[model samples]
Target: MTAPAIRTGRAGPEGGSRRLILDMAARLLRSGGYHQTSLREIAEAVGIRKASLYHHFASKEELVEAVVNDGVRFVDEAVAAALAAAAQAGPRQRLEAAIAAHLAALHGHGDYTSAAIKVFTFGSGPVPESVRLSRRLYEDVWRGLLAELREAGGIAPGRSPEALRLFLLGALNGSIDWYRPERFDIAALSREFAALVAPNGVDAAK
Candidate 1:
């Protein structure tokens, strides 16, 4: 299958300014979550009039949708690359690559990526549909990987891949609350989590 589209800077009239708005929006969303972030704040940070910000996005929800899509696309691409590179590796290695990619994608890609974890919730707003769609898209990718591990007996006998999926995502996503980049990096978390879920205490087949 073709790869997911990786996010890049936009180009057009006032494209640079628009990108700045999105970047600030992402940062505020990451720091304060959905309800706390406001379009006015985003505009002020972008050094544009509120009306000018509206030139790029009609509503706050619209701007947020773009940010969420960008975040999902990034991790989607990162995980795809990790999985592809591990094509010849064992299922355990594949899972390791996936875990590492996930951690790397979450924290290091700025607020666009981190904001995803922070503001990700279903709500009665323009964002709910987009939120669900973006999440399902990313989840489906990881689900495929877990299914393979399940088929190979790389998952525990009593546990299902779906459960593992929830566990892994929940754990990784919660890092926004306390993850200290100075103290721990994605590689370390990846290895630690990989060990935790290593199929009934075994990393791989003997």
Candidate 2:
């Protein structure tokens, strides 16, 4: 059988096709996890021949790599957009907006976003270094934000910034298992998190 038509250079339609391939790859990988999804599965989902994927990705790993990369960029843009929209807000508000955007970016909005939530095998077997770097860069963005909050006195006095960062990030990451749009609004969750980590506000009430 003739392989499905694919544009190699992504001049126009080929570029669209390339995006389709990436989107399909992200979905399949997000649903089945990286190891479970194969090039054949992705191609089948795209209604293309398995070999046709070669026109886009060199191998399954490459496609998965791209998915993770897309996920990183997706979250990065979200946080940046949140910060941009709140340029005039105080550090506390900016931090809250960033937290909300972070959760929104991870709320299974799409395969790329979902992939960021579920894919965590970086710096280990099968995961690439580039993926790890991208993930780290995202983490650094959070770190920088938290640093700003600490410097601005939004974080409680004498609180270990490093420890607080770990707790907040871990709490946010854990939402992947339990967070649901129907049950809890992303905005509320963000507000709650921001308050919880904000010095003596949420914790003091507790």
lDDT of candidate 1 over 94-197, digit per residue (tens): 88899888888888866787877776653435456877787798999888887877777777788867888898888988887778889887887887887777
| Alpha-carbon TM-score of each model against the true structure | 0.85, 0.85
Question: Each candidate's lDDT (Cα)?
Answer: 0.78, 0.78
| Each prediction's number of clashing residue pairs | 0, 0
What are the runs in model 1 whose C-alpha is more than 4 Å off? 1-14, 122-127, 200-206
- Candidate 1 — which pairs collide? none
Kindly list the per-residue Cα lDDT of model 2 for residues 1-206, writing each as its tens digit: 58677446635645487788888888887667766778888889888899988977888778778888998899889899999998778777787899898888888566697775566533235567898798788888888888877777778787887898889888887887788789999888888888877744322110
